[model samples]
Target: MNTLPQWAELLVSFFIILGASFTFIGSLGLLRLPDFMARLHAPTKATTLGVGGIIIGSMLYFSLSDTLSLHELLIAIFLFLTAPISAHLLAKAGLHLELKLTDNTRDLRKKPEQYSDKDS
Candidate 1:
């Protein structure tokens, strides 16, 4: 906005661009990676960082221009907390389903049937 100082504008713009780029790269990785396990790596790390960058930018912009902005921080915290957990769960599910992995992958876990016994 015209009301924002030049430095704040530049900082926000830089972070926003960085965030969008990371998000785009993550999406690209998902499409380009050759295997399911490899593909799972992309959105978990890249998208998390991407969203964090955008959230940081928004938090900075709003904090500087108006009252102390906290919602963005909360969103960032939630993303940080949940992304890895969700990724782990998804990966576990994939493993349980016996999804194809890259040629070089070495699975160390017991068979999915072990999980069934635990669940029972």
Candidate 2:
């Protein structure tokens, strides 16, 4: 078994704690937020970032412990790639169903004349 240097271990532990805290915050937001749209924001943004932190910490820990490899790299890549797409798809499905939007949601309606020629 390999032991990490003091600073590297400290950094890794910090990342892990930060990641767990963000994840907890995300879960709390999901439970306490008033509406669906508001609730969706927590997991998509906070949780993704939280997971990213955990992955980065894992990568650092493993890389320091053994021969550096791309296993953790691939997991991080896949996670960063998929989280947004999943969130977008869920939002689109909700929109297509005409689900209730939070009062704070920006009004999407706009006049056709406001569009630039490039937008037409």
Clashes of 2: 0
**Minimal lDDT window, size 10, model 1:** 106-115
Candidate with maximal lDDT: 1
Q: Write the per-residue lDDT of candidate 1 for residues 33-76, one digit (tens) a residue.
A: 98888888899989888998999899989988887899998899
Model 1 reaches what TM-score against the true structure? 0.84
> How many clashes (backbone N, Cα, C below 3 Å) per candidate?
0, 0
Candidate 2 lDDT, 1-120, residue by residue in tens: 989899999999999999999999999999988777678899988888888888889988988889786787888889889988998998878767777766787535335466546655
Error at 9, model 1, angstroms = 0.4
TM-scores of the models, in the order given: 0.84, 0.83
Question: Lowest summed lDDT over 10 consecutive residues: which window, candidate 2?
Answer: 107-116
Note the Cα lDDT for every prediction shown.
0.88, 0.84
What value does the lDDT take at residue 71 in candidate 2? Answer: 87
